[model samples]
Target chain A: MQSKISISNLDFYYGKTQALFDISMEIPERQVVAFIGPSGCGKSTFLRTLNRMNDTIPIARAEGVVKIDGENIYAPGTDVVALRRKVGMVFQKSNPFPKSIFENVAYGIRINGLHKNKADLQERVEKALRDAALLNEVKDRLNSSAFGLSGGQQQRLCIARALAVQPEVILMDEPASALDPIATQKIEELVVELKKQYSIVIVTHNMQQASRVSDKTAFFMLGKLIEFNPTQKMFTNPDERLTEDYITGRFG
Target chain B: MENRLLDQQLDLLRDKILLLGGTTEAALHRAMQSLTERDSELAKKVMDEDRIIDQMELEIDRLSVEILALQKPAAHDLRFVISVAKITPILERIADHAGSIAEAAIKINQEPQLKNYIDMPLMAEIAAEMLRTALDAFTSEDAAVSREVILRDQKIDECYHRVFDELIRIMINNPQAATCAAHLMFVAKHLERIGDYVKDICELNVYLREAAFIKHSPNQ
Candidate 1:
């Protein structure tokens, strides 16, 4: 239960409006933590703050501390690119590079110059695909366009791209919301499998998905972190009444 | 975010479970009355009414499975459905015990009248009261009342031990009275078993209210 990331007294703002209240929690290493709440509840926003993904917005401001592996990621002069490489992200929609499946996964390694040679790059791409649970499905079609794969396969390809960088942590924002049930199952299984090697933080609207894949769940509401508890306890007998109502579909 | 559809289905499930509880309670009462009054016809009626209890159990099972499969209830709803599903079979089994008591009553009535049925009637009353209180606690989701009902089972157990010793003495004093004494002993045993079943129901009620299993852990 060693913590990989720690956030203390963190507050986020967009322009003049505050988007997150003082939030603090420990994200344990090699465990999947799920963020769940209603829309506009700042779950996704808080997720982006982990890797400073919110820095892309000119009006965004973050206060307090977000430390990864004992190093404060929000400190001045922190290497943003290196931090992102350590914490890769997958979006809701599968945004493949419009390149071949192999190249799409190879893009991150190539940019980071992680491979020793062409053969090493090839090995890295295949390994990423294998780790993503997509190698068997796409092995014969690695040279084909990324768009040619099914929606679920394309989502896994995006995950493979994220994996190619060998991130210590993976942040997913509703990674399976657009896929069918079968596809969603694959992504859910992949999330469970990936937790053995990577600390994963996922923001999902689906409560069952959070219950299924996460070791711990953080419930957010109105830009405030209401409760963080073991996923089994959260779903069965949550301590906070707000957490109970939200999970039980009684929130207004 | 009020889920009216889920709420309505849950209401139906609650109504069905309560109906089954009421029916089982009635069966236990009628069976005990048949035994005390030496009414063979009433005993037969209790036996015949058992099929209705069986049918109700099946219906409740069907509804519980439907809610689990289609609604996919979580949190309190999930626990409530699971509690009802578990309690249905326990209630049905209690009714079966009552039916067995009614059978024993008919057999004992065929011979000469047994001694005044004092402790047996008291044991039956205590069992009926425990069941009624357990059902009320279930309806109100009252964990305190469930805990209280569980403690009441001890009273039934005490009465059972008393009846067992008294019946054994009677059988020893008059060897010819062994047949009727043996049947009365079975009636006492049925009431004791009913007490245990009521305890199980109370445990489920505690779980439904508090989300804790107090079955094996008495301190809980």
Candidate 2:
């Protein structure tokens, strides 16, 4: 199977300080990947590099090729806006627009000019909502303001909004941190369903949630990727004592 | 941290298990002493304390459940909690066997003693040593020391067979000892069972450390 994201000897620096240390990993296509570690270990920094989201802030420099489908995303003359269209992100906060629900989802497709007719936009919006599993709950009230939905429903709206672009890779940065347990489970389920069509990388503080939702698990510490292996092996018999200690509640 | 609370509860349970171990070891010695001196009063005291041992077993079980529920333990904690749970049954069986020894002492008090009990005293001494060493392994969390207990049980087993041979000889040499000899035979059997209890503790100790259940008998 082709790797959806292949990062090799990837290094990142902010001014004089480096944040990532010689990190190399492959996220296979259509599989859910989870990055777990103590805070400020650069999993989220690496996630931003996938879509060139870090380029917006000056002095955040990246070296080494971050390939998507065997194409180097960092190569000169690469259209970052087009690359970002294929790689969408959901943040820790839901951040649903103050607009109505239908418009919130419809905004992405309309701005991208992916559809010409109003009917086409409506069909695409409904399909994205359906794919997010938010269609049934929001089907009767698609015009209601998105802020009126509960935190979980609103997050699902954010996910739907990201999916509306029909991106091939979904970047979730602690997507369920602000949600309750039931809503976290819903997001976990959505990630599982979404992995059938999109390659996903989720950075989470939750160890058991990473064990539950991802096909592969990565452990990072002090700006280094300690281990990347199947989730079961990562949880049960991790190679590094530090990784095992962290998962077993012996340390952070 | 709540993990500190979990560790404290486990330590408390360990203390109680050792306390029960000390109690049973003392009771076994007293039961043997009663048999030696033909003291019916001391035998009754050993027998009555079996109820206290039974109550201790239930209390250990209750605390074990609380640790399992509240700690949501994994790995070694899970293994330690499970070992404690399994170790109770062995401890209870040891207490019951000691109680049976006391009953024998009581019964012999009502009748003439058998051939002066040359091997029964030796067997009880060896059996109590095995129990004491097994509890030592549990308290120190030493697998090597526990393995030593395994080796010593072999000596206890040898003593069991020797005691059996001597009892059979006594029964044949003097038919007048037939009733008293039967009780002595059970006493020998109970001492053999105490050896098995030590073996049980060794197995639980290995599991507590490794989360791996190692069977002593390969054929089984």
- Residue runs of model 1 more than 4 Å from their true location after superposition: none
* Model 2, span B1-220: residue lDDT tens: 1356767887898888888888888888888888889988999999999999999999999999988787655545666788889998788888898889889988877778666686677778878887888888887778777777777888877888887888788789988887788888898899898888878888788666544566655631
Q: What TM-score goes with each of the models? A: 0.98, 0.73
Question: Mind giving the per-residue lDDT tens digits that candidate 1 earns over A1-252?
Answer: 999999999999999999999999999999999999999999999999999999999999999899999999999999999999999999999999989999999999999999999999999999999999999999998999999999999999999999999999999999999999999999999999999999999999999999999999999999999999999989988889999889878888
Candidate 2 chain A lowest-lDDT run of ten:
A243-252
Residue range B1-220, candidate 1, lDDT tens digits: 7877778889998999899899999999999888888898999999999999999999989988998898778788888999999999999999999999999989988888876864999999999999999999999999998988888999999999999999999989988988999999999999999999999999999898888999999595
Candidate 1 colliding pairs: none
lDDT by residue for model 2 (A123-207), tens:
9999999999899999999999999999999999999999999899999999999999999999999999999999999999987
Report per-candidate DockQ.
0.76, 0.13
